[model samples]
Target: MRLFLVSQLLLVFISVLALTRAQTAPPTTTDTATTETSTAQPTPTDTATTTQAIAIATTTAWTAPPIFYPFGSAAGDTEQFENGGDTYRDVAFSTPFMFFGRMYNNTYVNNNGLLTFNQPLPEAHPYPFPTHGSEDFIAPLWTELDDIGIGRYSYQQYTNGSVLTRASQEINQYFPHKGFSASWVFVATWDYVQTSDVNVLNLHSAPAITFQVVLISGGGYSFILMNYGDCAATYYPVEAGYDTISSTDYHVIHYAFDGSYIPNLKNTSNVNVPGRWAFLVNNGTETENVIGVQLKLSSFLDLTLNENIEDVLQKIKQELVNRGASSFFEMKLRNVETDKEKNVAGRETFELITLT
Candidate 1:
């Protein structure tokens, strides 16, 4: 009985040990699986953090602002104008004639047609009409009226048998003693007058006449006019691109007047004045029109025209590399002056810098 009891106790101890070992082994497997899942999750987190860093880098890149320079003065300077007189006529008839007036009274017309108060009339002409016939007699009077001042001039003529009646407009001054002067002259006539009708009914009228005088400096002048009424808007088409330093990615792009390229002067055609440069931006697959800024010609030539064109391209490549944009982005230089062949000083090549 004692032996049997001792054997039973040993068996019981062995069974308890086996049970404990089985429980401990499952926990080891569970711990290993949990560690593997934690490691795998951290890898995704690292990838997400990397993506966020890239986004931040791209957003912070510097882009240049648009710059605009007007032809005459700094942007937003008010234009000046001056008015001299109204109607004072020594009447005549027949022939086309020009009216003259004092801008700065008693002023002389400079080589540029600018008037200085102390100078003499620079140019003179016999009134536009001849001093002959019934119509010719009245022409000088109209010329005299035009020379008296700066303003729009209108004339009317009436005839009864051989008698002709004439009238002209008086000057209405708005801008006084300003730097600019302008004038307009209109002439019209009828073929004949009826025996009893004082009112001229049938008349053939010429187009209205208009002219302007802009004094730039002491001797500079600009005379402008629009003879015809029909005017149309101007348009320009442009293509641009950039290339990588290693000649990796070269992109070619085009834009129309009404498309992505927005010009500063929307109403007029590009004048292509000397010393003007433009900047363009990438708008996804389509690039924005060369409208971001107007870099001065001096600045562009200084920055872009040094050394060989190829060398400049390499410099652009270096810039990309310094910015840490080497692996994924590239630029190819495209020719920008081809469309402006007449304005090109020489056969210079333009480069396109593209990002891949």
Candidate 2:
């Protein structure tokens, strides 16, 4: 009887051990398939989906922002451009405006889109800067724009305390160097101006381009502000920017060479302000120093795009060190890095970047 009891107890213990082992065993294939189903149901492609969304946002069309001065007949102080093709009107500034180391008290506002100091550029066709031309002009949009009985173009100058304060604040914010105070402000606007190539009788039915070129001067410093509004597409050669006497100091706004991109100027900006671009037209002694250094460096670097990029960079770096202009080189490197992040390699204008 004792031996029987011992064997029975031992069998019960063995049974309990086997039951525990079964409970603790690995999962079955079905269990694994269920888990994988939850994880693999198109949920792993989130990163790619986000990347696609970002690309769409980046490629979206740009529009003009409201950063322009008030204009039109309602403004009451504006002088209107005549309703004729390729017409120009001479206007005298209340104060002498300094531009690129020169002073001017009078300029002609041409309907085709240019401000000339000496005479009117009656030609409707646009030309690239350094035209090696004798005329000094500021072209907001040098296109064949027909204002004949259609669009209205106008000009206004302000020397009021309120206007001066606003101009000072804007220039300081955009350029951000030494503080600037404006004593004189000249505003020329091309409002609802249609391309001459268009044959529409009703201006409302035709596409139009509206923009402004504001000249600000004070404390021996000068600035130019190009404010764009709704711009229509065009097929003609369009040039927008400025040139000094003999093209000694000149800059062509981006997309000025291509007609398709002319409308894009309404959205493009140099200071990251949409619809607006601000440029320091005169820097006094600083301009002289830069030109001198530029000439010295130009002798070493072939900016004609004939040399390899790496070779050009090496030459510039060595020349900067020899001339104690390494600070300028470093600043350019920082600018290049910043522009690279924006993916504007060919579109951006940096110091010594003109490939003329």
Q: For every model shown, what is its TM-score relative to the native structure?
A: 0.19, 0.61
Model 1 lDDT on a 0 to 1 scale: 0.27
Write down the worst ten-residue block by lDDT for model 2: 326-335
Which predicted model would earn the best lDDT? 2
Quantify all predictions' global Cα lDDT against the true fold: 0.27, 0.67
Clashes of 2: 0
- Give lDDT tens digits, candidate 1, residues 70-179: 21112222222212232123224322222111132122222211122332322322222111222101110111212322222222222221111111111112112323
Weakest lDDT window of 10 consecutive positions for candidate 1: 163-172
